[model samples]
Target: MAPTLLSSPLQGFTDFRFRNAFQHYFGGIDTFYAPYIRLNGQLKIKQSYQNDLQLENNSTLNVIPQVMTNDPDEFLFVVKYVQSLGYKELNWNLGCPYPMVTKSGMGSGLICNPTRINEVLHKAHNESDIVVSMKMRMGYENATEILDAFPILDKYPLKNIAIHARIGKQLYNGPVDLDAFEKCISGTKHKLYYNGDITSLESFKKIQNRFPTIDHFMIGRGLIADPFLPNMIKNDTKAYPKNRWEIFSEFHDRIYQQYDEYLSGPTPIKMKMLGFWEFFSQSFPNPQKIVKAIKKASSPKKYQETVASILKNV
Candidate 1:
């Protein structure tokens, strides 16, 4: 069976603009998980978050909105908001490993506390009509954290649980613990989706061979590192378009233009593009040099010139 490919949400990177452009240029992802919509203490959703989920903005793509909150009231508020916008499934972001989010007792920090997880899931499942799914790590500090929460999660009828195979404190550093993830699969009753370190066809195949029954995968940084990875995985070949550079240039240009139009100043746009280049530069040869050039670009014009030169040479 063909596996399902999901575009994992990365804050500040996989916004509506990037999603639309990616879907337009490359079409392999089965569904796109939007970045978590954060509610400030004021209970108001940011305009940028609202814009990201507007139906019109995502008409051509299947999008699942994710919410990052430990508070039940906040979860319900997001449920009603997304339901009003016509989304049928909502993903609870218990996977974010950032200290800022975890320190607030949200994201991976909440995974170790079954009481809080139970409270949120119970309220969300009973009060909302939409299906609630969870994207999470094994724990904040240790792998056993998820074991404690599994029973509470079993009590709720979640659509699915996507595990990233690492503790939150690791913060995208150390290797993903496939052994621990295998244990998680045996322990949980909900459908599972694997998310982590799938940077190449070889790695993806190894995981597929190991877990033949698992069909869903949520790719984060790897997707940015190699945009064609999903296509390669689905096609089961390393073949790429002859005009790969041309297509990639066009895709990058579109994202640049979109961010240019939305952002206020040249510095913001330059910084934003540079951030993307941090991952995107990996797709090309001499990535360090290319990233250095992009970073040295002080103005929008300079950045464009550097990108154009790199694209031409690559």
Candidate 2:
């Protein structure tokens, strides 16, 4: 059977504009998980998050709303908010590995405290009818931490637990622990979706062949690094289309125009695209050279010319 591919949420990159453009140009993702809606001490959701989850904005895609919080009240508030927006499922984020979030007892930090995890889950399940799912790292300090939490997680009727296969402290570096992930298979009653290091077709096949039971795979930075990856993986081909650069150029322009119109100054848009190219550069012949060219393009016109020149090489 063909496996299901999911686009994992990256906070600054995978917004509605990017999602829409990606789906239109390269199609393979079965669903997209919107970046987590983080509420400050207040119960209110940010306008940017609001815009991302709006039904009209996501009409063409299957999107699951996500939230990052350790507080029961905050979890419940986000639950009601997404339910109001007509989303049936809310994915809880326990996998973010940043210092700011982890220091606050949220994200991967919450994984160690299963009592708090239970508390948040308790309120969300009891107070709302919305379905609950989870996105988590194995743990913050060590891989075994999730093993301890799984008993508590087993108590809830979660949609599934998506494990990123690395501890929070690793922070996207190091190899994903297949042995640790293998242990996770028997750790919970809920379904498990694999997420981590699925950058190419060969890497994906290694994971699939190892865990024949896992059907769902989530692609995060890998998706941005190579947008055609999901579709290629779906079709099970290593060859690029004849017009690979043309399709990518069109996709890039579509997003650049949308972001340029939305962001006020030339600087913000430059930084925004720069963030994307950090990953996008990897797909090119020389990542450092491509990134250097993008970085040197100081103004909007210069940026456009630089992008054109870069694609012209292809």
Candidate 3:
């Protein structure tokens, strides 16, 4: 059974470098989605955003580009640009929940208006001769929000519909409402994919048993906290970290080596590691103190030594 494991795109966590490095040692994820790019309604990509989408930066990884825009023109422009990069698939992001994004008439806020979604999908399908997909939440501010929009979404030629099973306001809090996922199954004819709160092996088992036929699952923070997560799922094996520190050292070293080669200096390196611990601390021993020390680290050497000390203590 080829379980279609997919690496979920976390804005700050999963990227070309992270996906590439993870695939190098543990190769289970079949396809990866690049973090959503905001088109700014200007038909222009920022330098940093361009760096994120560059084909050269991701030759080792198979990535489908994502665009977060409500404007049909901006959306089409971004999709066309990715097509220029030879990407055959484009994912629309109606899942983002930030107030800054929503208040500006994008992301989950866009869910409040189905006519807008219908217009954009109609435009994209008519304009772009490429495969288009969508990632969305159950609603903008409530679970029932998707109910009103389901008919419109079902009308589109969507390759897949990935649902987070929560409202925009929920923002990664609480358990995913499987009841709502059931609603998605009931409401739409689009092929469904699951994407929320799939962290441990046990949780995944529940999903697998419940949706025995589901082939695609998206994982984010969970994978960062445990890099072996995809491998564990693929083999249905448990990770026994006896040589815990050694494993930590090896993973850290590889990630850092890749980062150092690609990033400019200490500040960038520090930023990446610091952001990583937000999820990494979950599996670490005495995580609070270790994360504190890591946060307090003044130099790259200090950061490395601090990680070493924490692992040795374990």
Model 2: residues >4 Å from true position, as ranges? none
Rate residue 127 of model 2 by lDDT.
86
Worst 10 residues of 2 by lDDT: 121-130
Q: Estimate every model's Cα lDDT from 0 to 1.
A: 0.92, 0.95, 0.82
The estimated TM-scores of all candidates read: 0.98, 0.99, 0.94
How would you order the candidates by TM-score, starting with the best? 2, 1, 3
Q: Taking the tens digit of each residue's C-alpha lDDT, what string does model 2 give over 259-287? A: 99999999999999999999999999899
Query: Candidate 1 on 181-218: residue-level lDDT in tens?
Result: 99999898999999999988889998888988689998
Model 1 root mean square deviation, Cα atoms: 0.8
Residue 229 displacement in candidate 2 (angstroms): 0.5
Clash pairs of candidate 3?
none
Model 2 scores a TM of 0.99
lDDT by residue (1-42, candidate 3, tens digit) is 756777778886677777777787666688888898886557
